[model samples]
Target: MIFIEVIKKRFGHFEGETVWQWTMINDHGMKISVLNYGAIITSIETKDKFGEYANISLGFSDMDDYLAYSPYFGATLGPVAGRITKGQFSLDGEEYQLTQNEGANHRHGGKLNFSKKLWNVSVEKELDQIVLTFEYTWADGENGYPGNINAHMTYTLNNKNEWIIDYTAHTDKPTIYNPSNHIYFNLSGKAGSTILPHQLWVNSEKFLPIDKEMLPIGEIRSVENTIFDLRAGREMMEIIKNQDELLQIAGKGLDHTFILKHENGKPDAVLFDPQSGRRLEMETEADSVLVYTSNSMAGDFEINGKTVPKYAGITLETQGLVDAINHPGFGNIVLRPEKPFKSKTAFRFAVES
Candidate 1:
């Protein structure tokens, strides 16, 4: 059976805020709670083969905790997802500068991006889903970007235990856009524990190479003979210590975009927790995925009195490359009046035993 509860609170500069949580339960008795905030998955509780129920994701208990977290866990990122080199981009023969939130690059849509904004929430209890919508008008040059844009995010969970996230957007003017949700997963449901034991596989043969600034240097490299190779499922820890470009770029872990070799819209990656006997499959229409091992996470970034550790969480983001608008070879992320924008990504959880 599924259950839902509506919550209202006075939160963080925004008054009378509302968040709806939808709980999806399978026949096996596994439960997943998805909150409207960021379309965030607050918890995933599943019974092991031994009949022990355990949560397999990380998050805080209240809205205040989420407000303070710049971590971007299970949050929808937009306008443009990932890093934009030099904190700027050029469109229509003009260069526009954005907020330098990540060193010299504009990361995850810069400071005060879409994830931080409050969304209009809609609940569908019958479908076990929540829809969040928000609008932003760039006003010629907000954040040095262009055009007025409207966006919507729909999150749904099915009887089979799949969280379907769909994103749609339209712009009245020309602008660069790349929207995605950032969901950090820890199969063991604890922080400070390494995700090394988890087995991961990505369906990709090539990946974009980054410069010292972590910007795409406009080169595509093969994953063969490199730690980036996950074509054959391998323990994450097995490749963590390996000195490879992928690990080096992320400084002790991974934050690289893997270009899917096949674009059939099926699942391109699988992450399995051997100990829990639970698995997550990611299916999306996006062309590339940013696989990030939370190596930079520290306890100092506390939420709800709980400290989260590095390597305790992982984010798999499906979208265009970090700076797709600048690179013609990459997918086009431009939204214009004549063309509407739409994207979808889904994370499905299942028990092996």
Candidate 2:
């Protein structure tokens, strides 16, 4: 808990506004870069078992790249993180329609959602932690949603090598809210490297099955005998190479939500790279973890001077169920004026020998 500071560096201009990167460093020499634009995380540097540090989080260094070619990357995704069946839903007995960004579904709150907006930043440093707050407010009908919401995403980089995120929001009307950080991780630190070699473990025995459109088909099936089973920790390549029909539906990999069985704030999932001995543990207040193996990661854009192909990174999005507005018994995504939204998701990185 010795030396810790957050340094702000000028990144560049997006549109006409200047964007900056705030890099926070902790006593353990773990550093993380955050951007005011998109409220995105651009980097997370941590050590492996060999004491070598590398940035494991996927993102672009420049503002132009983030604005054009980035896939959510390390951005904060919200009002709702997953897909809405047909870009339509009914909340409070009133039907609502969201602009479709995916084929026939609404995803990540559309293209101009939280990830595209510039958020106001505030910093608070304490003896053991540095908290960065990104705030934004949207009108009631901004994205065809009902509510004026004041949302805040708080990130804390502590001496324990933990990058913790806490999401808070208050709305003036009834609205469906499910926020999640859309960060893809490649423990090897090589953008061109695939995560197929990594081992993943989820604290779930059940997963939501998806149809050909990648939307949940209203089933909470058991993962006991399926490739969705990760409770025993499975290698990514093993799961990808399986002959499961769902694999083909999701383009050869995962794009499903695993219902969490976390208890007493325990980690809901863990990912480890055996080669580097780098491990990442995640705990969240969300009901499920959206497991996306970057099934369709395009290699057109470069990162670390190399293009990362499909499965190059994996996103463990912790949030309520996808299309939760349509599935009341699955998970409640409703946010009312009387019951503001509050959620926490933490990622702890370490090296295990």
Candidate 3:
């Protein structure tokens, strides 16, 4: 059996409006805390082999850290999930300019990205699962995007210790859309510790190559002999020590998008922490998975009043290829009036024997 509860708390004010927080728990010992601001998952607690519940998602205990420079923490990325060169894209013979938040590129939307917006939240129980739905509408020309888009996301935690995220969106005009959740996970459930000891296996044979600026250079390369190869499940620390050029370009860590070998709704990656005996299986309908190690953290943010250093967590962002809007060969991220956008990603947690 699963249980759902709504606990209202003050999450600070945004745009002269008060934001709220909600906490959801299940019978399987899974608990999730979320906020309507950015529809962010503030905390996710799960049991380890020793049957101790620990919060695996990284964030601050206070609301101020999030309202400040959060580094994307557990926020929802939208409008576009990756970089668009020079913050410019053309659609239907017209060029659209976006805010360049990441140097010369428009990353994870724009200056006022979806992560900073407040969403409407609703709760419901379906069968044995508790679902928290968050809805937000973006007006045309918001952040320089040309569409009045409505987006909805449902986060469901079930009896099987599975957290499923369902995303759907509709647009009034033709636009590019690629939404994803940026939840960094540390199976050890301990902040300030690196995730290098974890083992990772990505079900991918190819990965996109990025330039020094961390933007995709329109090349899809094989992961056979490089450190990007995780088919046999390598320790993340070992991969980080390799002197590969691609890894150097990404701040000496793994931050590239791996092209999935499976189709939609198939298992894409597996992450296991031997020390904690916690295993995570990720399945998604998105075309690619961007695996990012928190290399830039460097004690920048405080979690529970303690500093969270670099490589504290790993992010498996499942979405369309980076820069897909400008690259015709990458993948289709265009959403027209006739067809709405839909995608799903799920994380199944278990104790490995």
Candidate 4:
């Protein structure tokens, strides 16, 4: 049976305000805990080969840590997924300026982006799955982005060990929109603090390289002869430790985007941990996957009561190309009233017998 629970986690910043934790537990020993504040996922627990359950998703045990130290941990990102050069973009002959929160670039919908907001949630129970739909409305001038957008994110957990995320949004005027979550997975759970022992495989032959400014240079380089090539699956430790220019440029590890060759949820990637015998299968309806190793961690955060390492987890964010607004060929991030935004990504967790 699938079970769902709602618990009051803590008090909010304002009087009479509160934060909540919603957990969905499947019969097969998989549990997912999400918070209403930022609609952030706090836990993703699954059983390993030895039939012991642990949280494989990196996050804090307290809500305060999330507010102070979260690097978009398990939070939804939007308005735009990546950096906006110099916090400026033009659409339909109109120039717009966004909040220059990250140096001179507008990143991840600004400082108080979607990752740090409260969302209204509605729960739905189907015969086999529990769906937690989180919704947030963005004002046109809130982040210097044109048009008001009503965004929706649906999280579904079923007994089949699937956690599916479906994103949908509608804008009242012509604007830009690219949304994805920043959930990092380690697969090894409490067995390991770093993702070095994990193996990753992505369904892509090319990757987007970034300059010193951490924005794409408009070149979609082939992954051949590069450490970014994980088409055949490889351990992350060797790749992360390689003296690769791109890796070093990306904070000493991967923060690159891979142009996906598959679509319509046809198995875009896989993450496995030999120690736990846990495997995570990913499928998405996105054109690209941003594979980010948590290379920027300063060893301040804890996962499962243990301090995490720099490469504590890896994020396979299925979203559009970063800063696609400036690059016409990178893919469209434009949202019009006539056309809405819709994307889906599914994470299937399993273990070898």
Q: Is candidate 1 or candidate 3 better by TM-score?
A: 3
lDDT (tens digit, per residue) of candidate 1 on 219-327: 8889887778889888888867787765777767888899986546646899988887778998888889998888788767653355676777778899987798778
RMSD of each: 2.9, 1.2, 1.6, 1.9
* Model 4 clash tally, residue pairs: 0
Would you list the C-alpha lDDT of every candidate in the order shown?
A: 0.74, 0.89, 0.88, 0.86
Give the lowest summed-lDDT range of ten residues in model 1: 4-13
| Residue 154, candidate 3: alpha-carbon lDDT | 95
TM-scores, all candidates, are: 0.88, 0.98, 0.96, 0.95
> Count of backbone clashes for each model?
0, 0, 0, 0
Clashing pairs in 3: none
Give the least accurate 10-residue stretch of model 2, judged by summed lDDT: 61-70
Give the per-residue Cα lDDT of candidate 4 at 336: 98
Clashing pairs in 4: none
Q: How close is candidate 2 to the true structure, as a TM-score?
A: 0.98
Model 4 residue 147 lDDT score: 94
Name the TM-score of candidate 1.
0.88
- For candidate 2, what is the lDDT? 0.89
Q: What is candidate 2's CA lDDT for residue 69? A: 81
Candidate 1 clashes between residue pairs 3 or more apart in a chain or in different chains: none
- Model 2: per-residue lDDT, tens digit, 1-353? 43999899899887788898999999888999999888899999998899988999898877889877858999888788889988899876799988888887898888689988889999998888899999999778877778999998899999988999999999999988898989999999876889999999999989988899898889889998888989889999999999899888999999999999987765899999999999999999889999999999878988979887889899999999899788756878989999988889989998988
